[model samples]
Target chain A: MTSILSGLESVKQALASQQFALSITQRNVANASNESYTREDAVFADVTASGGAAVSIQAYRDRFLDFSIGQEMQSLGKQQAQSSALSQIDSIFNENSGQGLQEAFSGFFNSFSSLSATPEDLTLRQQVLSKATALTSELHRLCAGMQRVQYSVNSSVPSTVDEINSITSKIAALNKQIPGETGSGNEFALRDERQKLLENLSSLIDTSYYETESGSITVTTGQGGLLVAGKDSYSLESSPLSGSGFQGVQLGGADITSTLRSGKLSGLIGARDQITGYLTSLDDLAATIAARVNQQHAAGSDLDGISGTDLFSYTTVSTGSNSGAARSISIAISDPRKVAAAGPSGGPGNNENANLLFAVKDEKLFTTSTETASQFYAHLIYRVGSDEQSAAEEITTQKSILAQLKNQRDGVSGVDMNEEAVNLIKYQKAYQAGARFATVLDTLSSDILNLIGA
Target chain B: MRVAQSETYRSFLGNLETLNERMNKLNSQVSSGKKLAQLKDSPASSAQLIGMRDQAAEIDQYQTNIDSGSYFLGMADSIFNEVNNLVTSIYAKGSQSASESVTADDRATIGTEIRSLRDQILALANSQVLGRYIFAGSRTSSAPFIVSGDTVSYQGDETANKISVDRGLEVQEGVPGSAAFNSIFSAVDSLLSNVSSNNMDGIQTALGQFASALSGLGIARGEIGANLGLLNNAKTNLGSQETSLKAQQSQVEDANMAEAVTGLSQVQTALQTAMTAGGSILQQRNLFDILG
Candidate 1:
């Protein structure tokens, strides 16, 4: 009777184990579409002394794939950010539309050529003033547009830091909970959630991380700024720079803006600097143009026979710095008669000075007198285009690499509906067999009872 | 390797996304007729396009200069011819008056004609075009020739107002009033006195002076003619240069419609095939469906 009861107990245990296996299959099927979910299996084992089955949950994942994907995500994030910023800048320098600084510049110079044709024509003098004003306005527009791009890019840094801090804090919480949930059936869920957070954090900032034996992760910035350690996470801060008022990143009160070499944050920083450099070049161009035109204009005489005054006026940021030259450039003289279209032997018809002013168009005025103003501006546009192109190309390459890695990872841990369906049937059949065995055991026990009836 | 359900879906979506991107690019190209919509599409080509545009603009300016230069020279050339004709008429009258058979009354009648011719020459010298004296050199706002007593004095300076007609080339727009009319005015003044006083030797000397003055006017007119020729040549050269630059610019920026349309259709067909394949694959029965 003890042996029959023991056989019944073993069958009951077998039924429970098979049901648990079916439940695991059900869980896999339910989460088949969840991108963050890892497939789980009920690993069955027999109880050595008790002669019954025991089960444990096993989650499928490749640690190496996770690490590789995280690294690739950082690159993808950086390229995407830079590409977006550069394309915005590319639109501002849209010379292809024929309504750019190039047109203004050529128009301004060509007006002088026209004035040289008929210096006595008051109408042509007015045309020169109008064209000069237009050129100055164009410079102002371009400079302002570039500054707006920089401001917008800089403004996003704080929100990005907030997002990174949020992710790190959640990861820290997961780190604390993962150890307690280890070896339990719920641990796999915590691990998968933690991995998703880590990937999210890595795309915002460049980070290196490793999982410890205790199932917790320690994350640090690429330049050794501690972000997450066990159950504690350090937060990043954004603050304005001293002179420029641009935002800079900080880690624990230390400026770490330069240390961030890759990721979205680093990409924004690089693009900001690139735009600032371009602004400086534009300022230099503007200042050089103003100075050269003013010099030539001063050497000539106007319609009233007075010596020429400055044709253009601009305010410099400081001594020897043309920081705001482009933004501040404006025509100094409003009177059309002030346009010096005459030589030192001044008359209403002398056009030697006007000819000289027109010659400025083809002069090598920038880049150590190697390129004309137009050429210099064209080069600036080319630089922006090339930068945007490279970033776009890098994004494509990085996306393919990430896709390949993700595919390999999905092969390792992603759910297979067919496999889950088959497991469902197999476990159901085993449970049915276990139930039938229990029925047979019951019949035997009853027969034994009848044989011993009084 | 085991293909997960999500993996097949992901790859199919990725392929569809790629095809859609190609289709979008081809559509933009076909619609805009410009292969380079943005500078980022091709930086080198964009830079070259800008350069070509600059060259084209420069050529346009040079052509305008040529036109303006031609007008100034053409006006001056015709005026010089008229002045030469007047001077020749006076010289013919002076030669006839210098002969011994001429009576005082005849000399006096010839004097009136010569004075009228001189007055006509003075009007021609002060000829204004568009409210500016054409012969005033750099002082074009006022008449360059001023009548003083019996002779005309040149008020205009010796500056030859030059306009740029080509790259590194300048052509004088007008000669100074002094160079064009000073000698002719002086010779005409002496011939008028000689005819009114009936002095044959003085009339003969004034006729010799008139011939030399006519030659001087001829030289000035010749300079203006040469300038017009230069401007015409520049205009022809610049026109052809502008055409070639525009052609190159078109090559750099304009899209090939045939290629773009062909690519658009090919991408459309590929996209249709991919969508159909994905649809069919997604609809295929799995193990769960078979069990149901």
Candidate 2:
């Protein structure tokens, strides 16, 4: 009877061991599609050789793979953020489109060339006037575009700060819950929730994680502000910008003054400060050109033997108290009869105006190293072309770099469907074998019990 | 000593992509034929280019003014010369009348000839260019001079029209018609009056005035000639400058077709090789064969 009971106890131990193996296999099969799920194995150990040697199973996991994957995800997130920002900037400039400020400048110049060829033609003069108008209009358009971009970026600053605050709060709440729930070693759900928060936090700003002694994470922002500590979250208050509902996040009632280093927020600030600054300089250049040209045109003789009227009036809206709102500029001939007569004495110094016009055709106007408007324009053209080429080159280089990084990262972390499918088959077969082993052990135990009863 | 295949591929691909992007950008710049695509491309450059373009435009406008001014001055010079010739013919006829052997009728006939020359001079002074009085300076709506009885009065401003020729350079293109021709007309008027009245002393005085007027016209003509010469020089210089600018621009921004074609071919070769290698790697990984 004691032998039969011993046999029964051995059969029961075998059955329990097979059941534990089957459950582990089933868990692996179920989690095959989960990215974060590590392949778990049952660690079987013989119970101290007493009472016919019972068996126990322990779940095994590799922590190294988990840490590696987390690192790769962080890098991938940064690359994605940078690539998106660059692409946005590139599209906004749209340099490939011919309808840009450069084309407008060229058009204005071409009109001048045409006017030069036929100085006496009223039609040509009118064409020049129209071209000047068009050029100025284009300048205004570009300025307005840049201004719009700036305003949009400024508007987004407060909102992004608010988002950061809210995300920090959420992460803190999860941090408190994760530690308590993880004491029983069943923090899978808590970990998933924390990872989701982390992903959201990364999109807003780059972050770092500090693991506590109790298996909970303390989240910190790029600026080194404590986001989550132990089980308690430090609250971040949204400081409203004056009467506006625009929430500016303050860490300790002090403004977060550090410029966002990366992410969409950084992109916005870059566009507002750097890109818009360049555009404003361009406007200054346009203003200088108009002012200088107008001065020269005013000094020069027209078809008439009169002067002092500006030829090209700048259309800038003055921000001063006494500003005139006139938009049109007149370049009238002072002496129409003189133009008609084709006589030398009809003009000053026997057609000196004609000589003046011809003299301006000299290369000195363009090649002079002086900071004059003419030379400025020449340099401007050269710099703009070169800058555009370089910027585009940089964009391509960055994009290629990003692609290569993505490929490298993907090689390590990207899910291979074919590999997963194979894993699914292997896990499924292991699960079936474990279940069959449990069934065989159960049958053996039942047969032993029947023999003892007889 | 050694480079990883992946690292080499990434670097080469990155460089190739960068070169391709640069080429595309250059092609766009060339095709657009503009130096600035946006304000950010080169703020200084864009600003400067706009200004230069405007300057070029303004210079062209000044040139137009100069051309018209030149034509009017030329007409004035020709008219003055014609009046001078007419005065010389009248003086010759007056010389014949002044001979002691001549009859009273001959003197009257010479006076009539002198009157006609004076009228011709008056007409020349009132000559219009482009429907405005050419000799009237700023007051172009009216004739530059008025003739009544035996005197001509100036009727135009003293100021000449000035225009910009180049940077830091401006030239007067329109001499007041009063200065160029009205004074000459007044002298001619006095000479005609003296010749008609048959006063030998007055005639002698009038001959000197006529000579002075002729000299003034010659001076004005010389000034016009000098201005025309200046204009020609300016045009020549401008043309050369424009040529050099174009060449420089081409050098900086324009692509060499031959070089671009060669580069494109090289990139294509590299791309083909990469694709072939990628394809082979993909083909070697077969889960079905492993499973079987």
Candidate 3:
């Protein structure tokens, strides 16, 4: 009698295990479209010497693949951010629309040449002033655009740091909950949530994380700086880079801007430097142009019979300092009658001065080196275009890599509806078979009992 | 390997975005007829394109200069022809009046004709074009020749004002009044005085003076003719140069319409194919479809 009861207990435990398996399959089929949900499996084990069963459900996830995704996602984030910023710079000039610095500059110089052709043509003198205004305004527009790009990068740093801190704290909270749930019950859903969080964190900044025995995760920077240890998360702060409004990232009161290798934060930093570098070049070009043009202009005589003075006024005349000369430059000589065209006050129709200014277009006056103004401007455009093009291509390549990594991860963790359906039917059939076996055992025992009684 | 539905969707979406961007780029090329809509499309080419454009613009300015130079030369050319004609008339009348057969009254009558020719030559010396005295050299605002009683004086400077026709090449706007007709006027004045006095020997000597003056005028005319020729050749050369520069600029900037249209359709076909192929995978139904 004791043996029969033990056998019935074993059969009942097996039926419960099959029911659990069916429920797991049902969960998988229901969550097939959920990107955050990983497929679960019902693991069965014999608990008694008489073959009694017990069940544990677990999620199938590859830790190495998660680490690869974390690393790959960081790069994709960086390239994406860099590309977005560079393209913003590209659009500001509008090259094809003829709304660019190049056209303005050439127009201004060409106007000078036109004046040289008919030095006494009052209409052409006013045209010179118009072209000068256009060129100066375009320069200011470009300078302002560069400032805006820098300001944008500087402004984004704080928000990005705040986002990082928030994400890190959430990861810490997830870290606290995952171990507790894993120790006492099924942690499949919690693990899925934690994985999603890690991927999110990776996009903001490069990170490394590992799972402990209790299923808790320890997070750190890619370079091994502790970010989150168990349930404690470190926070990042922003500090002024200089007396200027520009801010740099700080972790534990030490700037980690240079240490940041991959992610949007690093991309923003790189882009800011790129914009500043371009700003310096523009200032240099402006300074050299102003210096040379003013010199030639001052050597000639104007319609007012005064010897030429500086044609362009600016905050600074220094070329190498790059101290915002482009933004500051404007026409120093306002009176159209004050425009110098005579060589040494020779006569009104001489036109030697305007010719000198027109010659500035092809002269090596834009740099201390031998590059002409047009050449320098062309070089600047080429540099900017190259930077943008490279960034975009890098983003594409990084994105493809990230996608490949994601696909690899999804292969192991993703649920197939057809597969889940088969598992559901399989478990259901096994449940039915177990019930039939129990019924047969009951019938045999009852028949034997009747015989004994007779 | 198992295809994750989310990943497939994301990949298809990315591919579609890429195709769409390409389509938009080709559309821009077709619409604007420019291949380089942005600098980053091709950096080196963009820089080269701008450089060539600058060169073309500079060439245009030079062309304008050439046109103005040609007009100035034309003015100088007509003035020199007038001076040459005056020199020829002075020589013919002086030689006929110097012969012994001429009567006193006839010589007096020839004196008046000669004086009229002298006045005409003086006026020609002070010729102005477009309100500017072309013979005044750089002093273009005022006439260079002055008449006091019977004698003419040249007040103009000796400098022949030059205008640039090309880079480093210059042509004089007009010859100085002193250089072209100064000697001719004095010779004509002397012949008028000789005819008035009825002195045949003085008249013969004045005829020789008229011959030399005409020769001097002929030399100045030749120089003016040569300068005019230079201006013509410069204009023709500039036109041909402008033609070549424009062609190069077009090559750098303009898109080949035929190739662009063909490529546009090809890209469209490729996009359609990609969509169809991606469609087949994403359209695979769940188990419920088969069960139903």
Candidate 4:
């Protein structure tokens, strides 16, 4: 029952299949440079048990590699964010360039020592005032710098949330389109775009996602809060807290700021807390300076032979509150004569009180009486610097890991132009053989019809 | 690993970027000469540097104190030396007046000279240095002595002004007017009165007092000399401390220029190699190019 016409039909199907395979090879070569494009192969199969041929496009990709990349992207995002914020703090507290808090503190205390040398000298008294003024101004500048950094970090939350929402929206749209084009070669493009969007979302906030049985992906935050489910995307809200005026991230009316463990959002939140901690330490320094110096100064006599008042003053929220002390601290007395340089029992030449003030530099007064003001401030700087350094190290580690994962993914899914070229030659040769067979079948069928007519 | 065409170029570019970053870092280190441009570069060392700077500042302040103390003590030592000379002259005048062969006119002339010398001693006792009376104890704003007619009243206190020259070590900057010159003033008053009234017994007593006053001046000068010695020792010690502290700070902060420069050139060579390889590596003939 094998006829020339059916034989010709089988050759025709073979030729079409070869052409399809060649086109796929051409497509692979064309998209070799595209970062997101996964390589495709035309899979040929017999339509019948032994006769006709058919082809379908198969995309080369690994779901496990994509998942690993997403996780690494999250870690890299967190480290990069922390490193950047800490660098800003480090610059603000940089002492190597001089004119830092350490210098200001030394200047202030050293001025008191000089004042003690010439207790009655008006010029020396002025120097003490000037140094004190400079110290207060330095404290103010540092506090403001930290506050600005905190504010900037806090304000960025809304924009980051917006970015996450935008990415999730794109993912949901891709999720809708992926299942519709599942059997067709177009599904590869939809899946590639969705995977890219998922990686972008993971960097903004720690997230986990999985492809459903229907080929649609479901995305959730690290804490299992739904983001993109099937074809629907959820949005994150940013609202300010009551007392601090800092932005808090919320998902569907639930605060998720504290639950965020890794990603840019968490890193920014952690940075804000670190900055606040530094600010608190600075306030403690300012408050302790005001209280301790005022006590010693009040026990002494000024150049006018009157009991000294508080040398430094700051606004207080309550009786024992140290908050905002750095911002509010100021020299209480303006007159140079008001600087307490003499002891209570002695005349203008007495510098006992001035000596005591200078001695405050070494006192274990701040941080639960374990460190001097200078030591505490140095510790704060060390903490910031070390935190930044650790974050940078983490980023380096994460980046290398991410790079390796990306290369592994490339090995699985990336296009090879050389392989494509070889496929092109094989498919072209097959197509030519099928064409020659079709021409031979046509001649044989003509000869068979001529013999039957005779 | 099955490298894709894009992956090869991408990895090459990444390697080039890393090499370039290293070169830039080394360049900055060489140009700036500081290994720790930021605290984050080395936090522990940066903290140590801050502490060292603070200690240096403290040492500088202590040195200033030592200098001020030395100046005051040096002035006091010279004042006492002159006082000792005046006391010696007064004692000779008293001894001559006490001699029985001396004429009343001769005694009167000697008494006038002794009186002039006592007035000079009083002036020395009230000497002001840098607009503050040195011998006025804590009341240094005004003169310590008030002379009314033949007698001198001490207006200053008995307290000696102590200046801090070292930690827990305070040195008396100047001898109090009462301690250094009060007995001298009384001795000179006795000598003047005894010579003018021709009292030989009183003249002998005044000579004895003058000897004691000279010894008192010697004690005060001895204390001043001891303080000056302490100040000098502190200055030397602080100088060495400062030098050592600066050395430690440099160790923590300054970059090794030789190492940085060598590293820079090494990175440059790597970058050039990478670039050259990239040119050939990326242009690798695939089947498509060979076929064409």
Candidate 5:
């Protein structure tokens, strides 16, 4: 009952449909390696209940999967950021190679030991001075390194905020384009593009997307800031107080502290604060060591027959919530020779010089505590060592926790090369079969056309 | 549970693929022996480890301090013993000069010998241990005693030289020139004057002063000996304390290698089984063929 001419038209339509399917398969093969690319499938429908068919492409992406991945990524991102900051601090305080404050402390102690043996030896006196100098230098270096790490964190926070704003603007723009382009039900390309945007946005900041009936996506920050609502885009801007160092971010003059918790901005902010706290502790250690050592050294008698002059000079800077307070330390030898030669009498008969030496040696001149200089120094070394050891141990524990979290996150969203290879082979075979079916349809149409001519 | 041929099934497969990739990464992490494989893994822990490592490095310094203290103490003891011998020599010279058979010239010679002995005492008092005047106490920059015209005086204070042997215990190891040698010099000065004048009455008085000087030296020697004993005791206690602290610290912080290794092996086995089982299930279902 059907005309041969109509059969040819059906066959031509079938060929066109098969070509579209082939193109879609090729697109999948190309994007199998792309992290953001969702594999697309052909949507086929029988043509008006006749023996013909038409095909449309459908992207095989789950909205729920994307949403869940984004949430997990956000958590992983924050952990990574915090971990980075802590590791940097660790490198700054590298203690294993004997290149830290501990070594300097040991050197100082050794100098005192040598002095005890040849107390009147000029060479030993010089060694003590040298060792003292080295110890103070080590303290200064450590304090400076900690401060530098804090400064780096402070500077990085604002830059990350700027990146978040740029990503938000991009998402809002995509939100506008997707709804208009997909209105006629040909939204495969638009959806693909939007998915790519979401993936990109996730890396810069934690994001979630909402799909409306019109196929438009509404994007929001992990912290719940409206990134894209219909056709409009909301931007985030940070107004950091000078010297407060990028403490918080603002979106449209409203504070969004909770919203920024899982993004790169949050990570940077946390890192800055944590590093600053660590630097403060290091400064405290340096100040305490310098002050205590100088106090003991100053109280004790020196070879030059003078007392009270400091042995080490430490740089003073105001710290804590109380504002400006002057603190300084100086540890310097008052005299570098024998007390007898240092005095006017210039011999061992000088009782005044002898008395000074006796007082220091006996620790009777120490007005503060009954403890001697050597005892105090020993305690200081032990205290500092213990503090550093405890911190390192804590760091190790935190690292294990971080590792577990990362593994959990990776379990949900990592790419597998073997899976991609299998997908490529499968899609390739399907494309070939679709192409052969189109050829057979063409041959049938040709036979029908010849019959019509006869 | 049916073979997933629909787009939803394909999407699920994609998720499973991603999950497999993550598992591989986790496997590598486990094998690497470090929980934090990168700087970003755990920053706080890394920083803390650095601090602890620095502390471990400093333990050697405390040991060095103990060794140095021991060396100083040894030198101080030797100098004190020599001063004791010098005191004996001066007493012998004074006694010989006090004999009735001795002439003025002989007395003069004895006086010269006494002055020489005084110089020797000064040398001992001004003895430098390491680079410091051991007798000068904390005033290590100069000699504690100065001698001029046969009169020896202490340049340093009467305070004995003390070093910290342990917590709350400081041991004075060096006798000050003012306390030990200066008084002896004064006693010898009086004895020399009596010998030169041939005054038997003065000689008798000077002999009493010399004996008193010897007694003072004996007391100083006794105090130093006592302090040496205290130092030895403190050193022993510190050694034990350090050993106990090290054990406690290890318990608190160090990983138990045997336990860790066992745990690691268990996790590895579990991971391997999961991978093999998951692989077999996927293959038996032939999900890829069904989807194609």
Candidate 6:
């Protein structure tokens, strides 16, 4: 009782199924070169124990690998930020190039030493003044350089927060669209786009995401702070600090800067701390120089028979405050004759004070109480250099690890063009066979009808 | 695990980046010829270099002080010979007058000559070198002697002026005018009076003063010789110290040229190898040939 027309209907269903499968193979072949696009496969379901087909596209994803990549990205962001800032510090303190304060300090102290030879020589006295002025100017330049670095770090934080908000917004949009687009021919591409966005988001702020039961993804930032819950996204907020204050990221109206585990935000915070620490050390150097030099200068007499006058004064002159000492340091002596070159006897021929100033170069009078000014400054430079070197090494190391993780992800999801090409041919032949069978069944139905009519 | 096309490119780029970084550092070292181009290159060495440089500067200053001190001391030593000669001539004139074989006219003529010689000694004692009175102690701006008919007043303080020649060693800058010529002036006064009076006893008495004055001057010269010796020794010590410190600083700072050049070529080779590998891989058409 099975007619030729019903047989033709079964052949037509087979042709439609083959056509759908061919289209999927063609899509895979077309998108094999796309890095963000994952390889897709058709899922077929049976109906009533017969060869009835229902196909859906499946995009590949491994939750654990994505989490690992996110964590690694955060570490990479921090290392990169720290490396760049430290390199700037290294260049600022490069001694052999004569870009740093070492030469300036040596010139200043050496001028003092030379002043001893002919304490009455106007040229030598002028040399001392000129060198002192140059040293103070160099100190100012150094302080400004530190400020510029800190400014770069502080300014970057707000932009990073903005980046986080933008990424979260995109993730929310993708989440809303993902469920609606599933089984609508755009599901695989949507998921691919979402994954790419997540990678970017992870670089900006450490994050973890999970698939919901509704087939949507929810993104959370550092310490499980909500970023995107299904279709809803939370924005990262920022506010200007009071008086040279840097804006920090806020989540749910609470500041999350200190809690940021690792990311661009964390790297920037670490950079700010480094800048502050270095600034403090620089200030200590400047303060100590001013205080020690002033103590000796004030106790001695100049060529003009005047005593009790400071040669270098910054802030309180005697007390070396930690902040702004370098910027504040200036030559306090007005007349060149006011440069003290006399001892306790205070005779014009006495070059005892000049000798004392020269001796200051070798004095272990720093806070560390074991290093001179020159030694301390050199120590500062070496500390910053080593930090930069470590940062550079870390970046190379982290990049390698990130690359390996990415390879693992690629193994699971990357498309093979050669395999897709072969699949393209096989699907095309099946479609052709199904179409040829449908035509044969139509021919058979027509022949039976024609015979009955005769 | 399968390497994605992006991962391959990233790996190539990272390797190239590392090679380029090494190349840049090696280039800096080679061109600058400094292992310590920056303070951060090696902090301890940089700090030590600074200390070494400071020591070198200190040594140079010591040398300057020593040279300056030696110049004045040498001036004093040469002038002391003139004083000794004048003192010897006065002693000869005093002994000749005390012999009693001499007439009054002869004694008078000798007294006038002795007075003239005494005036010359005072002039020599007040000698100014380099625009400052050499024997005037710390009050170097003026002459140290004021002559009045029979007596010479000593205006210069007897303080031993000193110039620092070493970190802890200070050498006498110049002989004090009072110490050098005050007794000589008294001796000359005694010889002139005895020769004028034609008294053999007084002339013999003045001869003792001349001998003592001469001996005192010899001792002052001896001190000058000691200081000059000290300055020379200090100069030698400072020179050697400066050389040693400079060597230390160079060790901390200057790069080994051979090592830097070798490193540069090695890094360059690595760079070239990485680039060639990356380029070859990029040019590969595995999928294209298979599909075609």
Better of 2 and 4 by DockQ: 4
Candidate 6 Cα outliers beyond 4 Å, as residue runs: A1-35, A44-53, A240-244, A316-320, A439-454, B1-3, B38-40, B89-134, B142-178, B181-204, B210-216
lDDT of each: 0.88, 0.54, 0.78, 0.86, 0.57, 0.76
Model 6, residue B149: displacement in angstroms?
5.1
RMSD of each: 1.6, 7.8, 3.3, 1.9, 8.5, 3.7
Question: What would the per-residue lDDT of candidate 3 be over residues A64-132, giving only the tens digit for each residue?
Answer: 888888888888778777878888888886664555887888888888777765565567778888888
Task: Give the least accurate 10-residue stretch of model 1 chain A, judged by summed lDDT.
Answer: A46-55
Q: What is the lDDT of residue A205 in candidate 1?
A: 91
Model 6 pairs in collision? none
Off by over 4 Å in 4: A47-53, A449-454
Q: Which ten residues in a row have the lowest lDDT in candidate 3 chain B?
A: B158-167
TM-scores across all candidates? 0.98, 0.68, 0.90, 0.97, 0.67, 0.88
DockQ of each: 0.74, 0.12, 0.46, 0.69, 0.12, 0.39
The DockQ of predicted model 2 stands at 0.12
lDDT of 6 by residue, B217-276 (tens): 888888889988888988888878777777877787888999999999999988998899
Instruction: Find the candidate with the highest DockQ and give its number.
Output: 1
Clashes of each: 0, 41, 0, 0, 81, 0
Best candidate, TM-score: 1
Task: Quote the lDDT for B41 in model 1.
Answer: 92
Q: Write the per-residue lDDT of candidate 1 for residues A1-454, one digit (tens) a residue.
A: 3488888888878888998888889888888888888889899897333565488899998989998889988988888888888888888877777788888888999899999989979999999999999999999888988889988999989989999999999999999999999777689999999999988887889999999899899999999889999999999999998877889999999999988888899988888988998899899989999999999999999998899999999999897999899999999999999999998857888999999999998899888889998889889888888999999999989888888888888898899888888898999999999899899999998999999993
lDDT of 5 by residue, A287-403 (tens): 544455555555544454444355555564444321111122334453455213123322221223322332342252222555343333333333334443444454455444433
**lDDT tens readout by residue for model 3, B109-214:** 8778877877787777777665657676545556788877667777766645455556566665557768667787787767877888877888888778866777
Which regions in candidate 3 have their CA more than 4 angstroms from the true location?
A47-53, A97-99, A183-186, A212-214, A222-224, A317-320, A366-368, A448-454, B90-133, B146-178, B181-221, B286-288
TM-score result, candidate 2: 0.68
User: DockQ: which is higher, 3 or 4?
Assistant: 4
Q: lDDT, candidate 5, residue A408?
A: 38
Q: Docking quality tier of candidate 1?
A: medium
